[model samples]
Target: MGWLRGDCVGRGSFATVNLAVCSQFTTPTVVKSSDVFSSSSLKNEKQVLDRLGLCPEIIRCFGDDYTTENGEDFYNLFLEYASGGTLFDQLKNHGGRLPESDVRRYIRSIIRGLAYIHDKGFVHCDIKLQNILVLGNGDVKIADFGLAKRTEEKQSMCECRGTPLSMSPESVNDNEYEPPADVWALGCAVVEMVTGKPAWNVKEGSNIFSLMLRIGLGDELPEVPNELSEAGKDFLSKCFVKDPRKRWTAEMLLKHPFVADNTLSSKTSSPRCHFDFPDWVSAGTASVPCSPESVEWSEWKFDSVRWSNCTSPVDRLRQLVTDKKPNWSESDSWCLVSRHQRTV
Candidate 1:
């Protein structure tokens, strides 16, 4: 496959993604390549994508090959080009957080992909906004399967892979995991989509040990984004359950109010909200190390109702700040305010 490689688009620990075009094809595509000696492991990812071929919500893989550039032998994988880039880029474009409706649509697509992958006996060990690719039509597809493995593959105890902030509690603690671990990561991605921040309050250069303790050993979980709807919060509660045995499966979560269509009845039960803090996290010897940017969230209200109007001064203030337009006299502004207030 003598495809002409063009500009480099992405760089990761294992591979570099570049724009590529073939003589027979009219559209630009992306090719991910890594040194043959590097551990990026394109072979495994190619196998996973090949087995999971033709999913509308998953990035398509054309084929793979070997190429040498500048005396280095490299293995390469060709993938569908997501013109809209990644979900992480999308979130940044929206000023850190995406609108709830967009988040709902993206999450629904992701669930479909996850369901298919799990049904096929594989787990997408890494599920984060950065691995989610947005298409030109605004649809999203799950990408980057380098860390994925078969459900039957035994994991080492306390084995951690993928991004730290998006990892599941079980992955952080016992290191034993199954499909539910992806659901946990999905929950973290949703929180990031809504809050423009990682699920933990910890920040850059903070104590990673403390972060892991909070995620794995605590009765406390990641803070639900304040901007999310009650249904959204409840949905996260299901994903963040301490017990994977009791966690909602992707099939079950599809019917959750947060992701289901408006006409679809949400038969989802209330998310579990109680647990004892792990002994290590609760040891009063020292407060968990935190960053200056760390945020403290209050208890989430599972039974809260959405507000339909700016019925109070506080609501008005919230509207003004969130909408970013303080024009009180314009009816259009009032409409904007009401629209966002409904998300409360």
Candidate 2:
């Protein structure tokens, strides 16, 4: 499709996400681009999305292509643009914690997506709040599958994958990432949503080796927040089971009372009910060009001003305003400025 890439929206370790306007579509799409030689993760994500097919809780991938710009080859993967940003951003916007009702709705959607992924014989290695994107309608979708892997592949890999805080015990101990690992990550995500803190108690200068030992060899599990309801605590208990063999699967979690009772119909009552469209969409048309390069300053008079002394245009303006202060003593009358009042 013919498209024009706009400003950069996000930057990952290996790729850059930008807004793009396509000729064939009305809504803007996000394009993640990376150097052709370093785009293995992007290619893998595209393949995984294609294999998973259509799911409302999963981010949709459009297509991918290769282009040469500035004599450098780049691989671009097109995906649906999420207007409400990531779940982490949602938490930050709402003073760090989300209402339990909203958390239930989001968790239900995540479980559904996880169940589908598990059934497809894959494990999402990374399942943190940052990887979950919120929609304009207060719904959530799983995104960023760069660390995803097939079930069989996960067993053979010895290196750990995914964020340290969300890593399951088995993943850290044996590098075994399966459906249960995703469930553990889900538990971590839920704790974060309800308590506005990481499931693991990581300190500012904590050693990585010590943290790994605690997760892999220690008997303790992530503390279920006291703020959670009885059913919510039970649900987390099943997820935080140290034994991966005994941990509840995503399919089982869907039937749990904490999330099973909640429905998308409650979205109207959610605190984040208002729409958050992108800045570009809300910015209306301008009569004159708005770019800095298009500005003309030749008409303004700079009387007895040393241009060399002024570092910027703002400094020049400040100097001019200070020099031309109004003489209040010469005025016979003064006008009071008050906030405009509307009449019913």
Tell me, by lDDT, which candidate is best: 2
Supply every candidate's count of residue pairs whose N, Cα or C atoms clash at under 3 angstroms: 0, 0
Q: Model 1 — which ten-residue stretch has the worst lDDT?
A: 297-306
lDDT of 1 by residue, 175-279 (tens): 655899999889988988887766766532333344556677757777776567767777887787778877778887887767876543334334343431111
Model 2 residue 53 lDDT?
97
| TM-score of each model, in listed order | 0.76, 0.75
Give the C-alpha lDDT of model 1. Answer: 0.68
Cα error, candidate 2, residue 14 (Å): 2.2
TM-score of 2: 0.75
lDDT of 2 by residue, 257-304 (tens): 788875433222211212211111111121221111122211110111
lDDT, each prediction: 0.68, 0.69
Candidate 2 segments exceeding 4 Å error: 154-157, 263-344
Predicted structure 2: lDDT: 0.69
Which portions of model 1 miss their true places by more than 4 Å? 24-27, 263-344
Extract clashing residue pairs from model 2: none
